[model samples]
Target: MSASLYLVAMIVIPAIGAAAVAALPRERGLLAKQVTLGVSLVVLLLAVLATAAFDVDGDRFQLTTSVSWIPDFGAEFALGVDGIALVMLLLIGVLVPLVVTASWHEADAGPRPTRVFFAWLLLLEAMMVGVFVATDVLLFYVFFEAMLVPMYFLIGSFGGPRRQYAAVKFFLYSLVGGLIMLAAVIGLYVVSTSQLGEGTFAFDALRQLDIDPEVQKLLFLGFFVAFAIKAPLVPFHTWLPDSGAEAPIGGAVLLVGVLDKVGTFGFLRYCLPLFPDASRFFAPFVLVLAVVGILYAALLAMGQTDMKRLVSYTSISHFGFIALGIFAFTTEAGTGAVLYMVNHGLATGLLFIVVGMLIGRGGSRQIGDYGGVAAKAPLLAGAFLVAGLASLALPGTNSFVSEFLVLIGSFPERPVFTIVATVGIILAALYILLMYQRTMHGPPRGVLLQQDPAEPLSGTGTGTGTGTGTGGATAASATATATRPAAPGTLRVLDLSRRELAVVAPLIALIIGLGVYPQPLLDLIEPAVSATISDLGGTDR
Candidate 1:
């Protein structure tokens, strides 16, 4: 198949797979899961091949193909990828399979049919792929709006007790943003018509239009609000905690991992290139939001009792760094922002997966309910610790390099904002370590030590009470007594199974591998970032 066809197939195959999985016998949940996994693996392979075929020093957009769709309006069913889009595509590719694997037993808790769950997941993947590859602004908007359907179902049908509420909130927030963007999309086409003597929604064509300064600001606000809500900066970020906490682990992973990146990606792909004057005009205001998000979200994360909610808040703070990098108008920061998108997905996705496993074992999302988990499940605790440390951007982990790049790159351009944002790292360390200590250390308590009320304590004597001061003899007798076997609901934690290990192994490898050397990813990202900076009339240094 030709290279452009590969992009089309990456989308079509999973969509077809979703239909096929949905058609299978309702009783064959295991088969549906297997088929979904197989489909995701195939897509991953295609993504890898596409990455390999991508020439780093090539056209701004590669593997491109366009077919006219709405001739009167100058819209087309166009598709392609630049370095930024390609890396995002690779992220979608890597994550979907891991989510499928990690969610093996996640569907069992929900009332929905397992086939439907996997099917929705497959469909969501296809939509995510479409969003990144779409070259036509109209095509991109359709995919952007279309993504809400599967995710809505994923949360509303298969999420926690408040699934419906959370799903509605998520949908409404995104829907409102998308509608505002719709106005901007229409406005953009109008400007194109006036400038070029014809209407068009092709991104390449629209970027060349010399829009009026005032008009650009108005149009920029419409697009910026939509992306801010989607990127979920402060004030617009309330929906994420509810949605993230209520959605199934698999849905939550994709929600925070690949889905959130769309907003920041939009800013890079659309806002800067299309309205250079407007982007520079609004840089200071955006930088304020970015710095505020880093500090504010980090504080919120430290106070969360729900494990999933805590992780989701961390993503908000991480996104601030991405926004800062983008507006800094420097190659180092913009490239770091792109790389941060990929690394955050890996690190935070792994964190959610492990937290899900912990909740599965202990039967609670409350951090107060778990203590000394390490004693019973050392491997699981170790995985959670690694994920937590990576979340905090510890040295030798993937996030550290990206965070480093973002801070250093943004500093020269926006020193005060960069300095304020750096404080988030200290807060990050405190929250991650405190969370790990509370959940993994301390004396075994709560679920770890719940005992039958009828059963005697481990150090107690059999129906004997001594009021006398023979403490030495009593202590010796208690030490010599045999320990009782554990009863149900007590000390039942088990270590990670083979399948669970298989799920996390690749993420762990990537975390360390990319941390040690990020040059390969940098090579693919830097050229594109430089091109973008050049367009913005900024110097990399």
Candidate 2:
């Protein structure tokens, strides 16, 4: 099949499934789960085929599709895939199925479970695919901004106590940032028309147009600010913690896993090559911000007591690494940054899913609420530990390789920033291990020990009793103890269920697989990155 058909199928399949999920009968909740999973799997398969069909060695956009959407403005329905887009598309494909499985229980939870939750999830998948494959700046922008809607609903409706607030904050922050980007897109379109005698939103065409250095700088800032808000570097990052903390586990996974990459991807795809002079001029300042973000976010992550919030802060720090690589302007660093995008999604998405499971079982997100859970839930604990280790970039894990490459690649160009960013790695160890210790170690506290009072006693002789000597004797003892129960003993923690294991097993395998042999992905990304650097008139290192 043609790549354009595959891309269209990627979008339409999920959208059609979403509609089907919305109409499915509640009694057939299992059907909804199957359909959602089926759609996601198909999308993943298509994305794989798209990757296979992609001409990595060609060093030009592949599967090009264009149609005049607005001829006067030179806007076209342009779509294509480079190596970067291919990687991101693969990520979206991999993550959506995991997210579907993660949220499988939600389909059977409420009175109308199949209708709302599954539908929103499918819609979100469509938007994410659109975001990665779009080639026209306007089309990309539309998908970029359109994503906020499904995400807002996902968080607001299916999430935690603060879901409403988090959703609103996330929506507002992204909306403002996107409006700023829209203005910049318009400016770019207008400038192209004035200078080249034709307006265009085609990325390659815009890249070829020469604008004034001053104007380029201004245009660059417009694009930079928008992506910064999404990348959420430093001051613009406040929304992520709240949103991640409150979003449903699947929602949080995609939010951090896929959407956040749009920011860094923007820098690589548009900012650096299209505005080479401005990118060079702004590199130092952006590197400063990226380094500062690394340290600041790591420190903030260290102080977080909520597991989700801690993970969110860690994302901020990871994105700092991506931003640092982009500004470093080396091919190796840039490629590592791209790799970092995929690795972060896998490792952190696993963290969110595991933490969400912990919350479901323990009934709270407070760090003090859990202790010695590993004693009972050894399998779950082990998975959490592995995921945490990956987050901390331990060797033999996917994150370690990407982070190592990024640091080595950036060291020459931004030594001070690289050195400071390395400290963030140290801090990453502190925060991830500290969180692991608090939740999975020590003794259980808080609500892990609550007992039910209404159950009738059986031969076991617990709770209320039937007529029997032992039961009567125990009843008197229980009454006496009810006045002042002894301090809670060690709590029971259940190991991960087969269902839960199914959700995270693939992620663990990939973490190991990619860590041990990442050459396939590296090979795929290199040619396109080299071309991007050459376009900016830089030597590929």
The lDDT values for all models are: 0.84, 0.81
Looking at model 2, which ten-residue stretch has the lowest summed lDDT?
458-467
Predicted candidate 2 versus true structure: per-residue lDDT over 167-284, tens digit per residue: 9999999999899889989999999889888788999889889889999898899889889989989878999999988787788899999999999999988898888999999988
Q: On residues 208-321, what C-alpha lDDT tens digit does candidate 1 reach at each position?
A: 788898998988988898889888788789999998887888899999999999999999888998888899999999999988999999999999888878898999999999
Score every model by TM-score. Answer: 0.92, 0.92
> Candidate 2 vs. truth: CA RMSD?
7.2
Q: Which candidate number would show the highest TM-score if scored against the true structure?
A: 1
Write down the TM-score for model 1. Answer: 0.92
